[model samples]
Target: MNPTSPFDAERALSLARETLTIEADALLALRGQIDGAFVQAMQAMLDTRHRVIVMGMGKSGHVGRKIAATLASTGTPAFFVHPGEASHGDLGMVTPGDVVIAISNSGESDELNAILPPMRRLGITLVAMTGRPDSSLARHADFVLNTAVQKEACPLNLAPTASTIAQMAMGDALAVALLDARGFREHDFARSHPGGALGRKLLMHVRDLMRGGEQVPRVPADASFSATMREMTSKGLGATAVVDGDKVLGIFTDGDLRRMIETGADLRAMKAHQVMHPHPKLVRDDALAVEAADLMEQHRITSVLVVDAAGHLVGALNTNDLLRAKVI
Candidate 1:
């Protein structure tokens, strides 16, 4: 790579800053242009029984794809169909009751326009997102969202930069408004996204990875120290819940055993409740696994008790379980 001089580096940085400033101003202009048409477009999407089909050409098509994805992920059913492809055979993707969003910065893409007449004849609601309202696509649209920009970020003033940014921002705004209107909650979003780390954090409950039933290291309140140690060793969790039936009385970890030894206590005479930490940090079995992680981290402990709504010792979870579940 050729090393650049300080003057050249400064010029490059200045131009980059100029590009961002231009896009920022473009968004301000676009915000002022939001009128009754934006609301009508939003209402069309809300009222549609079928899905939303987004169409565009060139860079506008790229923006349209992201917009469609945003809408789909945020509780709105939407997809992008290339206008060029639509003209060939993908036109059937547009059906009655579906809303069509056609995007073109210039408001006139020949490929996009070629199929507009047929799409219009289908009686689908047509929404045009363009900078030029007088252009053919805008004129033919049932609703028009003006994405007018003063200029491009390109020094030559030719590339679709500011205009595209404005379109993307408007699309995001629409998606957020629709999301609010639908009362889409985080749990609803978690239901939609149930496969990644995000899904694990939002949907994975403590019971999902917790050791339950016989798997839980547990001993009766009257059990001997040796009995508690055996329970911990047998369960392989390095700890045991000192319980009375299903009700948790306290917790006895290896640390507690070490502390008892340090204190020179008569280990043979001590009961489970005598050496246990009372009212130990416990998590709900039904709570999100992420919440369990938070509790452990906050308390500086490696394991936690998972209890039921009635405060019964229902399960056990540790840092290792969290790692295996990919929730940490």
Candidate 2:
């Protein structure tokens, strides 16, 4: 009985790397199997008027839930239904127009197979994702998308590693195909993920987070520098817009005042327009808030003017406002 050498860390890492390589190769092989049936599955889902109801058991169930979420977020309305629950009266959730995607490695999950008959009776289209094309679920399916893997990454070939990855990748393929078919745009995706950073970046318009009406720190271009300073202080935005009618002529910021004073420019003798930085960076009302943030960062400015299509100063926003809105 020779004792194992003090838990060889390097050997453990080597084995882990080998497992990852095997899984990666398996996925690459799976990609080659996509064919007409894959297209048919996507077409079936797109043609269905009701939501996609994903069903599976055990590890497949977990993967199915994630697939359902990805589909919903990408513009296909979908949800997961436990097949075991469907056997126990949850089958009522399935409707005639819905498409059912059943996931199982062997395509013979008893609980999942149990709900298929009723789903078919209700006129629901069945799309089976399985490793075995000859299995019961695949035999009954209107379309079968293969997720077969030659072997698991596990040494004993028992774990669901390579098979689960294939299933998830196939699910993604279905989602992306549906997304393209529906012409799902970035704005649509942003609407679904409004609480995420990407949503804030793409969906939020400058006008949505800008300070307008009386809250805007603005002064006439010809007003005294003292008045501009007073406006900045009263508004608490650290800057003031110098406007002439509806047009923005310049901006007077704390930095601008500092430079003006250092240049021996007398505030008492100068008008706001004379000392203000002219033609400051401006953004359109419809511009994405993230783009506004990028412009401000590029110019090293703390604030920006929100203008309408005709270049009229409609609103203003500072760094603090962007931060508050979580657009940064």
Q: What is candidate 2's lDDT per residue for 1-328, written digit by digit as tens?
A: 4597588889899989988998899889988888899998899888888989999999999999999999999999999999999998899999998999999999989999887887889998899999999999999999999899999988889989999999999999899989999999998998999999889888898989998888888899789877877999999888888998888998888898788779886689888889888888999989989999999999898888888999988888889999999998
Tell me the whole-model lDDT of each prediction, alpha carbons only: 0.92, 0.90
**Candidate 1, RMSD to the unseen true structure:** 2.8
Which stretches of model 2 miss by more than 4 angstroms?
Answer: 1-11, 244-247, 308-313
- Candidate 1 residues lying further than 4 Å off, grouped into runs, are 1-7, 196-198, 297-300, 309-312, 323-328
lDDT by residue for model 1 (150-232), tens: 99999999999999999999899999999999998887787778987788899999989999889999889999988988999
Model 1: lDDT of residue 115 = 92
- Clashing residue pairs, backbone N/CA/C < 3 A, model 1: none
